[model samples]
Target: MSTAIASPRAFKADAAFLRGLGRAFAGALIFALPMLMTMEMWQLGFYMDPLRLALLLALTVPTLVGLSRFGGLRPTARLRDDVADALVVLLVAALAAAVTLYIFGILTPGMSAREIIGKIVLQTVPGSFGAMLARSQLGGEPEGEREKDPPTYWGELFLMGAGALFLSFNMAPTEEMVLIAYKMSAWQSAALALVSLGLMHAFVYTLNFRGGSARPDHIPAWSLFARFTLVGYAIVLGVSLFSLWVFGRTDGDSLKEILSASIVLGFPGAIGAASARLLL
Candidate 1:
């Protein structure tokens, strides 16, 4: 009798899981499509340093796990569940990359195993982020899942970092990042940095975007700027540097060159960080 009662429940659970997988795949493809199709990305795939790539994949796991805690496709109530979702999101990312690349003629059986694996691994970081965010962006969660509690200050910082990483990662492989850096004068770079910081602050506290946190009346504006905007931009800068390094953009570059490129990437990264609550 118990088995009979459990059969329908099991079927329902399986169905829901399958649906979650579908959402994950959709998210992965949508988020990773640009990188998958870019020629530079393809070249970097086979040529990128193995150690750096490995570190990227390793870091991605924790990032995905953290994202799962806040916005997993399933309503996770425990650390184990978050980990499981991270793994599942990775699987979804891989499958999405493999299928899309195959259809695009980028992945062929004739290609070396190393090449194929490298391409997929590189794409997986962004893809997994998309999968983890599918619930929030695509809007299908299993029944009875409550909204996530408000994030603490650190939690907010993590979200900003994740957002910054996602946006910066998308652009890091492109040649334009370096070209723009080269074209700019030192004064121009300084102006751009100030502009980035100003826009980020505006987006977070001044612009009044729907999901933006309302600054309490008693909390002075400068305090909020120092506490969130400055810190978030710092995180964005770190993410930008890491993304550039992952793509070998910093190989043999001088400190001035590296900082210039980082500031260029940090414009979008800062925007991503400021709007994380809206996006992720």
Candidate 2:
């Protein structure tokens, strides 16, 4: 009698794990397809600074762990479970990236191991994020099924940083960032900064976008702005700068050029940060 009951439970657990893996694969592909197909992304995989690439990949572990804590391919009950989920997400991301690159003819047998590994590893960053978010975005679970504990202040900031990084990573490899920066005058760059700030503020506070947070009745408007909006923008700018640097976009560029590029990328980054509650 004991074995009969145990077997069914075991089978159900295995089945659920398999379903989670399937969702992770789909999420990885759906989120990472843009970078997988981008020409600059392919080139950067092998030619960009190896240290930077490795560092980025290393940083991904913590990011995924944090993501698992908040929302992941499955509900995790403990820190150890979250870590395991993060690793599983990474594996799924790597496998998805490898298969997609193979289908695209970018991961040919003729390529050296270093080249093949580089391409897949570079793509896995975004893929992992997608895999982690798959549950929240694709699972379509009712709000009641999700975690009830509200995020703390630092947790909110971290999500904003993650969001900024995700959006910036997609655009950082493209040439348009630098091109637009080159074309714009100093005054235009400043104007764009103001616009980014205003739009970011509006998205979170004024526009009342779905998944946006409401300000506490006791908190003054300026206090909310200073604490959340301004701080979130700062995080977005930092993430944008880091993304640009990771892609070698800032190499040999003047300080002005770097700042201009960062500001340009910060536009999307700001939007991402403001929308983190919705997306992440």
Candidate 3:
């Protein structure tokens, strides 16, 4: 006699298991990505200037701890959620390039002080809302599905945005900010801003990853002490390149200056973000 096919309930169970496995895979990639970006920042800086690289390492501790405490809430959290935060940090690095380039007409002839002020105010609300909308859309879960958390959404956003923005800006002034602050043209500022944000995002993401679930056999090449070095480097390279292109600079000197600014620029966002992440 032929055996009976698996029942509907069995099929449903199998399909559910497969979906979970898919989610886990996606989550792992997302979780691992931030660490990759962070590694790139540290590696590139170390390759260029090891002493200053210490500062980047130093910044990671706080970011990881803070993220553990204050990052956006997820259903399972499961490291994948952490990855989303890190990616957004990376995206902000790209936005800095846009800001520096005046892609939104920031530096145009009509951008008087009043206009700038008005624009900043006008954009802040919408910009924040846009970010929230993006986050909500990315969640993909129905509104009813999200878990309940303490009511501190705005506070966390403020900390995340402020910390990332300040740190990145400090890492390297946008060529324009550098120019205006130190007298340089818009294009140059764009380049500087891109590198700075890229480094900052990389640094923070790594810090977040450091807090990731530690596995017993993460590496065997360095006898299990490698800490995802090559993977991290790969991430940083993309993070840096994405921002660098956004900044619009290909010059060796410009890139050098931007790299050097990483540690110094990372301070504020590091502190503020860490603090905010912790408190939130």
TM agreement with the true structure for every prediction: 0.95, 0.96, 0.28
Best by TM-score: 2
User: Per-residue lDDT of 121-168 in model 2, one digit per residue for the tens?
Assistant: 999999999999888888756755776477899999998898888788
TM-score of 1: 0.95
List, residue by residue over 1-280, the lDDT tens digit for candidate 3. Answer: 1232357777775575445333433433333223223323222322323333234334433343334234332333556555554444334322432353255344367555544433332222212222322333244556455633542634344445434442342233134322332343455545644554444344434355432223345434353122332222233333333233323332344654544333233334444343333322
CA RMSD of each candidate after superposition: 2.3, 2.1, 16.7
Residue-wise C-alpha lDDT for candidate 1, range 1-280, written one tens digit per residue: 5575569877897788899999999899888888888998888889999899999999999998888877778778899989999999999998898788788888887889999999888888788999888877896554235568888999999999998987888899999999999999999999999999999999988888977888899999999999999999999999999999989999999899999999999999999998998888
**Count of backbone clashes, every candidate in sequence:** 0, 0, 9
Clashes of 3: 9
lDDT of 1: 0.88
Could you say which candidate leads in lDDT? Answer: 2
Per-residue error (Å), model 3, residue 273? 9.6
**Distance from true location, Cα of 63 in model 3, Å:** 1.9
Could you tell me which residue pairs clash in candidate 1? none
